[model samples]
Target chain A: MLVEIYLIAVVVALACSLPGVFLVLRGSTMLSDAITHTVLLGIVLAFFVVNDLNSPFLIVGATLVGVLTVWLIETLQHTKLLSNDSAIGIVFPLFFSIAIILITRYAGNVHLDADSVLMGELAFAPFRRMTLFGMDFGPKVLWSMLIILIINVLFITFFYKELKITTFDPGLAAALGFSPVFLHYALMTLVSLTAVGAYDSVGSILVVGFMVGPALTGYLLTHRLKRMILITLITAVFNSLVGVKAAFVLDTSIAGMIAVVTGITCLLAFLFSPSKGSIQAIRNRWKQRKNLKKQAASSHIKS
Target chain B: MEQLLALFSDYTFQIVALGTGFLGLLSGVVGTYATLRKESLLGDALSHAALPGIALAFLLIGKKDLVYLLGGALISGLIATALIQWISKKSTVKFDNALSVVLSSFFGLGLVLLTHIQGLENANQAGLEKFIYGQASSMLLSDVQLLLAVGAGILVLVLLLWKELKVFAFDPVFTQTLGFQTRILQFILSAMIILTVIFGLESVGVILMSALLIGPAVAARQWSDRLGVVLILAGLFGMVSGVAGTFISSIGRQIPTGPTIVLVLSLIVMISLIFSPKRGLIIRWVNQRRKKKAYIKQIEEKQERSEKYAR
Candidate 1:
């Protein structure tokens, strides 16, 4: 059972980390953070209308709202009235607050568990079963996670050139006949989609870890975007597996434990990665200082 | 109208009003630095880190004294911040990760202690938990007085170090070369940030306190380029949000103050994001349109001039 859980976790982590790589590179980290918060409104609103948290319409509604959040923030950012980060900071929290308000006003009248929006249930994920065409399949969590992974893979592959060009040099990309704006929105939509769907299993705090941690750890390992994406996928999968099993053994909060473990992995990568690791960066500086000191000493001795 | 007037006359609303007002002021002033540094998450992290310090202070001192507990919280938050710094320095961990580790550990420790206290069924624990979400309605006049004093002290410190802080923020290397004690100044500023978090944690609860610190500054940044004005404006935004949230919660029986304040503060930030003069999105769109029009006009005139010359 534990082995199955770990396998599922690996798949889940890899899928979420795919879009995270691009989101981090485009400097839309905060948008992803904002989307994670705003999804509560989407989920609860969908629940209010559909009366079922388990319905697939919840994912659709959340994704659509998440896309709207990205669009609104982009529109706001273009105005130059506020910086991009501040615009995101403003939009998502207000949406989240409204969601919280709706919950308080309408609690117990509906089954929209507001607390579940904060800390998702990763351990109990294996229990939620899915049904296909006349056969009782495995968990719904696994199926939804698989569906997101497929979408992420397809999108990343199809728009690989557009995304790469847009991320690196929007001006050059525009000159070369690609609309950076289109690609930017596309990327954000995918991020929000994946994040909103993924959070149902991983929770808000751990979603960020999956988003940034793997990409960051991969960044330490390589500079090339392709390699970074691949490595980030691996790192995220490993992190999720480690975090879930550790939580099971430790008997603590799964989401919080995953976040802490992600932090630890990032720390490890920051320290020991061959090039530009924190310790390596510091060592080079020290070596440069020592060389300078030696040159000064040699000149003095000669004199 | 008479009953509303009586509410104003009562002591509870007065105390609640004053305490939140002081918190609003401190949050606005300190939040400017957080937004500028782009470490807004630090606001959230530090608040959680202060939780255990409050519980520990109560445990050791056997008193629920706000000042004493706040001091303990301040010290512990600083230590957590320091530990995050040290770990980032000495090890390979990234800044965000270090923050994550410290925040969770401290919060988890606090949770354990709190649940233990709850199990003990101690009478003192009775309203102590209220600090987490902040029940400003339950505050006394003494609490209000302490808040005002702390708020005043923080404001003075911000004024005293305004020049140094600005230089450090914009260009630290230049400031260092110009003979400023960058480390001490930074340490002091960072300490002030933790203090701000600790102070707001009492009324906003540790989890919700970051909204107070980060929200107004974000809104203020949209409206102005001058750091000083931005700081002041952020403070004003905080004051408005604080008062508004408190008022709504007081009038509405079931609404919690912290979430209401955060929601209200968040609304101001959104308004600034889209509508604030030069930085606003609508104005930028207009500017781009105008610039494109001017460029087209210039091109047309130049072509006409060339045609005349040819003739």
Candidate 2:
């Protein structure tokens, strides 16, 4: 059971983390945050309309709301009424508050539990398995996550050149005839598609951590984009495993533990990366000072 | 309304206003440094970090004094900042990396402890939990006075050291070249932020205090280019929001004061961004329209003069 659950955790972690690399690089990290929280408002509204969590219409409506999250944030940014971060800060909190307000006001009418919707149990996920085509398959969540992961991989692979170009240098990409805006919208859509369930799996807090942590750790470990993606995926999987294993042993929340483990790994990378490691850089400075002092003393003797 | 007043009137409104005001004044003074350092986000992180401290304070003291709870919160907020700073300095992680590390970890740990604290099932626990969203309506006059002393002292200290802070924030390279201790200046500033946020956590709660710390400073920035003016305006804006938000929340029974204060702060930021004289959108539009007209006139005059030459 734990093994099945851990697999689901990995699938969700990868789905979040793969796009996270691009999200962080594009400085849309906060976008993941905005999408994650604002989607709750969507889920609540969808639930209010259909009153069912398992309905496919729920996801369809949620994705539309996710797009609105980006749209609202962009619109807010355009108004010059708030700075970029401030606009996001204002809009998401308002949306999130409204969702909470709705829940508090209509707790009985709503089937969407706010706390569970915010965070979910990966262990219990395995128990919700579905049989597809008469073969032994995992949970519907696992299948959905795998499908999203495939989309992310396909997008990353097929448009790898375009993505790298646009992300690294959008102006140049535009001048060279690629539509930055198109790429931007498409990427945002992908983020929304992946984030809804990704957020559902480990919760908003962990989804962000996964989205941010693996990619960030990879960034510190390497300068190249390809290596960064591969490393990010590996580290994300590792985090999910450790998190799931720890939760199993300690009887703690898998999502919370995963967030903690990923944070710890990022800290380790920060401390020990060869080129930019803080301690190594500081030590190098001290060594240079010691050599300079010796040279000064020796020159004084000669004089 | 008269009957309602007769039934509901008490010391709580005045006390809550005084508490929010004290918080407004203190954070406004200290947050200038937070903004200047480009570490405004730290306020958000630190406020969240105070949860563990609040829990620890409750456990260690086995008492429920506001001062003790806040003091413990202050220690934890400082710890969060210190760990973030030290980890960043000692490792390759960037500032955000250090920050996110402390933020979620501390917040998660706090949640875990809260699970235990929830089990306490006492009167203190009921009121104490209000710190999650803030229950400013419950503030005692004594708590407000304590906040006043702390806020006033910090305000005086900031006033005294205004020149030094100005020098440091505006041109750190220049200040360093001038033989000033940059690290010490940074330390002093961050210390003030930690202290301000500690007391602030009680009134505004943990999550929303960052809105208080950054919102006024951000709003004030759009109105002026001068550092001193920005600082003073920010402080005033903060005070205005604190007071107005408290009054509005008082009208409603269930609305939390902290979010109300932040909502008000956001409105002020909106106004400043759109309408301030120099940085605001209106000024830019007016300037651009004027420039475009002058350019069009220049082209017309050149075309007319060239036609006469051809004739």
Chain B alone, TM-score, model 1 = 0.91
Residue-wise lDDT of candidate 1 within A1-303, one digit each (tens)? 566567667777887788878766665665676787788788878888988878888888888888889888888667655455556656765677677777877765665654466556676777777877978788787888888889989999999988898888999999999999888777777777777777767765456667776777786788899999888887887777777777777665555556667666766877788785767878899999999999999999999
RMSD of each: 4.4, 3.9
- TM, every model: 0.82, 0.85
Model 2 misplacement above 4 A: A45-91, A106-114, A117-143, A286-303, B1-8, B56-69, B86-94, B112-132, B138-143
For candidate 1 chain B, the 10 contiguous residues with the lowest summed lDDT are B107-116
Predicted structure with the largest TM-score when compared to the true one: 2
CAPRI quality level assigned to candidate 2 from its DockQ score: acceptable
- For model 1, the stretches where C-alpha displacement exceeds 4 angstroms are A1-4, A131-136, A293-303, B36-41, B48-146, B169-171, B205-208, B218-230, B266-311
lDDT of 2 by residue, B1-311 (tens): 87447434546776787778768756765776677767776776787788778888887777788888888888888788888888766654556655655676666556545545656655666566566556667777787888788778878877887878889887888989988888888777877887787777677766567778877887888877788788888888888888887887777655667767877877887788778888788888999999999999999999999999999
lDDT of 1: 0.75
Q: What is the TM-score of model 2 when looking only at chain B?
A: 0.90
The per-candidate TM-score of the B chain, in the order shown, comes to 0.91, 0.90
